[model samples]
Target: MKTAMLEREGFAALVLRLRAEGISDLDLLTAVEQTPRSRFVAPHLAEHAYSSRTIPIECGAFMEGADLAVRLIERLRVKPGHRVLEVGTGSGFMTAVLGRLSERVVSIERYRTLVTDAQARLDSFGLRNVILRHGDGAGGLPGEGTFDRIIVTAAFPAMPRAFTEQLVHNGVLLAPIMIDEDRCIMVRLTRTGSRFEREDLFEVPYLPLTPRVAAFL
Candidate 1:
């Protein structure tokens, strides 16, 4: 399918996909439709682009579980002018999505190769709002603390203190939390006063948030 077709037919289908997934934000859905997920994916996965299914891309990475990603970002309450931090810049897919929805996005990746590819791809797409960082995803970002939102794309074994401390009061953290032996659960965290509270959401598998998150703490 051509890029132009995504504007209309693609938008329609994306609306349905989000609706099926319970994404109620209309404007966010529009951004999702316009961003063109197909371009960021492997050429072979292009055909499955708008199906609400995450397909495997280059470098042994799978875009599986992106629909949950969209929902999580929306739940994060990102406004157009919000500054956000993203842990795990894999494929830069979610980073690009956040870039479109927010004014500034600082995304960190532990793997050098993923950082390089994500930077190149996002730059090619003209998403200048996203700043790519080469570092450990687990450490939380060094300078960009007090963000309006911090998104962790990979699942962490537990919530890192650095991550929770970095959030400003009322800032939301959306990430996958590992619950049991092999269960990866998605959760939304809202910082209140001196403490934070979590609301458990769904279940899915993702690359566990790397150990780098807690290296400094």
Candidate 2:
């Protein structure tokens, strides 16, 4: 009982920090608060579930910090009716949050282990709106039809043309673009007619987006 209380208190403190960082959307905050982040991470790393830093997960992937994930989702401007495509569903933590914010979420992960684990966690939460698949997310899922929003968790050398083409009119795509060997900037691209209006949001630290799905692991 004492441990549970401490966990709750820690999470509450994390929520406070997020609010201070300008995450004022009531619904977004509620989703983040309600989702059990600890369940999405490895048992040994549960204590750092609410921390504002990345945690290593299965298949050698890292889950983005809670603060960064929420900020990027905020920039996407997810709506209750929006269909979101999430590339790199590391822990399915963000997938669950996106499920709460949007109508439907199709999340793809490169590693089969990550996909299986994430699907189980999402299912436990009864998030039926999310679909988890094991595939290369480098080029967004174009065959799934157009989406209202697309968020890439990994950093790419350039804006992926396939992702931009998979967005519906006026749809938003948020991704980290590598400006150089060590510099990465998060960019928001909005589809307008036949062109995309790009807005550089902020710098971020993310692993490079790789091609092809993992055959082993």
Give the winner by TM-score: 2
Best by lDDT: 2
lDDT against the true structure, per candidate, is: 0.76, 0.88
After superposition, the stretches of candidate 2 with alpha carbons farther than 4 Å from their true spots are none
Question: What are the models' TM-scores?
Answer: 0.87, 0.95
Task: Return the number of clashes found in candidate 2.
Answer: 0
Clash total of candidate 1: 4
Local lDDT at 131 for model 2: 92
TM-score of 1: 0.87
Model 1 clashing residue pairs (backbone) = 138-212, 138-213, 139-213, 155-209
Q: Please, what are the lDDT tens digits per residue for candidate 1 over residues 52-101?
A: 66677655666754466677777888998888999877777778888889
